[model samples]
Target: MAPSDYPRAAIVTGADQGIGRATAIALARAGFDVGFTWHDSEAGAANTAAAITALGRRTASSWLDTTDLPSCAPVIEKLAANLGSLGVFVNNVGIGLNSSVVDTSYSDWQRILDTNLNGAFLCLQAAAKLLIAGGSGGRIVVVTSIHAHQPRFGFGAYCASKFGLDGLTKTLAVELSEHGITVNAVAPGEIATHLGPDETRHPHDIPRPGIPLGHAGTADEIAGVINFLASPAASYVTGASWEVDGGMAQMGAQASSHVANNDWRQATRKGTSNGD
Candidate 1:
């Protein structure tokens, strides 16, 4: 088949729910066949596959535990064989643990690091090899987090793993650009998803009160950024971390308070404030 006639294939890990699920559907809608992997949510994965099929696109689902590095190559091989070619690889598999450095156990730290950092590295390596062998320039988009840049009070392990991912993204971007592959990341903050609960209050989840957008973002919003990075439109963009937060990460404690005060003043001026 000619290059234009070849079917486009994309693999999205952790795609059973949240940002990953949204991205899989978006890519399918964009006319790319999808190969998605879920670690524990078989029903959710099947639902995602059905959604893609409903979009008139092909989809395949797999049970992929990202922490298993040795399984990466075989899974990629199987996905490539099933889809014809892999044009995009999304490293969306990650784990977050909320614990202070002193409270975090070694095993918990290792689990978070292995899943968030090592898994991403292994998947990227396997995908790069497959794309190079196929002789097709591919796109690799990693779903990093705002914690990759700014550390939270009780998420030491999570922050460390994401910081490592950020560094890996930049390194891979430099190394893979020569091969016509682009490497980039999307950093989302306070997104409402199964991965991040809205009701469960964590130190990181404390409403900044000063975010310019003034609300938590949705998983679809973050997925939109990831989808864009995987598309032809982002061909010239790489080695960057696009923040999809509602300006929460940009506000310092004092700045956030100031913004809240300003909002209060505006509300009072407009007689819309609830006087306590």
Candidate 2:
């Protein structure tokens, strides 16, 4: 295909693996020339680029430390230059912290916020400038988590960052709608990626009760939601967060399952029932 014949262009942060990789490939398959960023995994980034190119879409990969605001400008500039235009931006780069607030050091908190929240803002700003300059309007998708809506035991920092990102998505949607740019967030839950909890699980292992769907999600499933948002069909959609979490967000009934651990339970007619 001629260079000009390529559909639109997209940049996916953290595309070295997991949801970011899947999003990049999905966009490529949807006719977008894809660019992606990796932090410390050049091999993984190369693999993602190769996959996109295999789909007959142009691909560009760069090393990006999302925590460093100064490092973002060049990555965006280089990708936009190579892709010829910027039509979509996916804020998928983030680090998860599995620590309690009490145990999380100040540096750890800052690192999480810097990478997950501040970095996303910087990226959106850079991409928005290009999209506004191009005057074509564009899609901005932030890959949040189910924790954005609910807190978890060991994901304090992660949940906070995701919540912040969701707020950013809504605010940006309202602000950028006039310019025709759409801002939205995809909150995924229990996606079975290398970085996911299910990565080391046995195939026969039972699904977590927290997920009402009875199974973990896959990266491609989340990517499908993102792809739809990036498409023209979503032109009327903005300021929304699609919970691509397979009903996890709606499983308010799961709270009853936690009663199994309660020690204060009444005795049944025949015997003492400990609930569980």
- The estimated TM-scores of all candidates read 0.85, 0.87
- Please give, for residues 91-182, the per-residue lDDT of candidate 1 as tens digits: 88887765669888999888788788887788888888887776768788988889899976677888898999999999999998877788
Which tens-of-lDDT digit does each residue in 1-276 have in candidate 2? 121321399999888887898899999999999988887577888899899989999988888887787888678878988999998998888778667788889998998888888888888889888878887788899988888998877677778989999999999999888878889999987766653364576422647665667777878898999999998888888999998877877876756665466432322112110000
Task: Please identify model 1 stretches exceeding 4 Å from their true place.
Answer: 1-7, 195-208, 253-276
Q: What residue pairs are clashing in model 1?
A: none
lDDT of 1 at 31: 88
Q: How large is the C-alpha RMSD of every model relative to the true structure?
A: 8.6, 8.4
Best by TM-score: 2
